[model samples]
Target: MSGAPAGRAVAWLPVARPLTLVPAPPPEAAAAALGTVWPALRRALAGDAPLAVLPAGAGPADAARAVLRPDRPLEPGTDLVVVTSGSTGGGKGVLLSAAALRASAAATLGRLGGPGSWLLALPTSAVGGLQVLVRSALADREPAVLDRGEPLAAALARLPAGDRRYTALVPTQLRRYLADEPDALASFDGIVVGGAATDPALLARARAAGVRLHTSYGMSETAGGCVYDGVPLDGVGVRVAEGVELTGPVLAHGYRLDPAATGEAFADGWFRTRDAGSLAADGTLTVHGRLDDVVISGGVNVAPQAVEAALREHPSVADAVVTGRPDPEWGQRVVAGVVPAPGAVPELAELRPWVAARLGAAAAPRELHLLDSVPTLHTGKPDRRAVARLHGGDQ
Candidate 1:
């Protein structure tokens, strides 16, 4: 146990308590199920048996239960357990207190002006999606939940028009909305995009089309996006040592039933985010990418995200992902998987020089695979491991 502040008792770590697991309904059934889950959500937030809401791809309840281990005891004060792969692509249960979740929602609404009706476009399993519901509940309004394949216009129109309308989206969803129904996107007072980094070019396009966009950076550990538009939220703090670290009241308590992992991630009231970044003198954060995402080719270190950004700037590329592949000569080669712009087929020859100009020769992709669409997780983040396999590379 750690020492508590004056007049407060030290909260012992790893208190044992069981939690209920609520497997989220499939996308088609989610709208109808929202009403049923809302009451349970309220109870959970109020410190009833805490709930772990599983994501859709989690399969059947038995399968989810196997992975989540609902029978295992959780820490005291944990009101919600969010199962997330995060940036590492390994599943873990993040233990969030009701206070932390509420703090995050309050800070988000305060940052976006005030509380308002929200449009739930992302899956409820992820923190981003759950935060929308959490915000809506706190504001005393039901969110307009978007079913799978629902049009953005139709979804936005579902919300009551009076209060400030807001929504959260991943970069893939934002890109699609910008291309297909930018008018609908512009209707929102604010849009929070996260789950992965938003491309600079995509941000420019959305802003040009009159969309109010906030780029978010955080994970389940912070209850979802403590940083918006490079600035930390009201009480959230950002610092960089070996990697980015965030300190705030909105952070989760720790990982449920994984003390070893939790101990490594959280310490001294700060969560060590495994992302390489820098903080400007003005306190703005510029994320360099994940510390583990660097690829070394021919003794030159290359950041895949930087290469991906360069690729996206190419006129013929709609989207791109860079992964490192084992090579006998270079030790590791930078490989690219690209989704071409409509009616455009970009060649490796054209892209090689294109990226080399912006980044460097080592950063340029040695191999290119033209994909019809980038493989993405249900959370709308590009599946980097799957993207690596596109060119037969091991992730």
Candidate 2:
């Protein structure tokens, strides 16, 4: 890592020689970079050195030049800054302490029944993928990586067997993997899925197929996910304000060099999330959707995810993205773009009753369109802006 200082928020960048920065290498090299973060992070936490893990296409020297300043030194104990997946909007660097990472790793392992080897399938630049490295590092084990360029099944075939296999995947990846190679996915001892809200129908199918799926909730600010499978890990706390608020050892120090952004998101030791959810009396946290997810349709707040989830239940629908289109009469009309199953083209006539039966008339899509696939960001998450554009026939 170049240009990044070793101490938390110290003016190390100005005083010390321009350091090497950790380039966010391509996915092909993500697994290989797993070992690099440990020592650098250790040094950073112990001495307050700042380590910036730059995403691919950028080099270590860039982070130093971009954010390092004598006026804003990282606080003591700040270790690593992982970039957020800007799927919703712009990405930001989240600063986390060594203790936060350790707490996350320990709590995760305790929840998952001791330490085991993890497989790297998600990008190392993202917290989901980086935490895989962190967990594996803490366990003193090397994780297997499935290069992004290759087919998932082929990559799984290349993985070393004989140890308990664990991996984290976004819902899209898991759904595709389960459809393509059920046996291979079932071979894993655990599979953590996040990055977006998962449909209940999908989860049921996964469970029936014997996939140990764990849905997680948290952003980079929470050091990845402090809540796994609707339950908070040890030392993790959850509260519901306008949305969900989390306080725990896994919380990040703050956003790097962006106090205004940090102050707004983190306060009273709790990191507030954009997701709208509720906490059950038994401690189950049910995340409905993002607070910004609602679209006013005919004077009613409509959650497109709920509509999309219902659409996915159709046998002919392989995947779906639901959005609201502005209409003169309705204000916003619900529309759905569906990736049809092999040889299936869903029509609105049949799809309407299908959704209305489950989610009521208001939630039913007013229009249905066939799509080859859903538009996604590099992080393999749905590009909502682009998807919304698709509603206007922006192919």
Clash list (residue pairs), candidate 1: none
Indicate the worst ten consecutive residues by lDDT in candidate 1.
58-67
Off by over 4 Å in 1: 1-17, 58-64, 86-89
Q: How large is the C-alpha RMSD of every model relative to the true structure?
A: 5.3, 5.8
Cα lDDT tens digits, model 1, 1-395, are: 65667797766676566687666777887685476556667877788768877666535344446657866666778898887754456677888988998999999999999999998887777788889989998999988888888888998888997889999998888988899999999999999999898888889999999999999999989999999999999999999999999999999888867889989999999999889999999999999888888899999989888898899889999988888999999989999999999899999999999999988899989989888888876566777887776667875
State how far residue 17 of model 2 sits from its true place (Å): 10
Residue 14 miss distance in model 1 (angstroms)? 12
- Scored by CA lDDT, what does every candidate get? 0.85, 0.76
lDDT for model 2 comes to: 0.76
Residue 84 CA displacement from its true place in model 1, Å: 1.3
TM-score of 2: 0.85
Give the top-scoring candidate (lDDT): 1
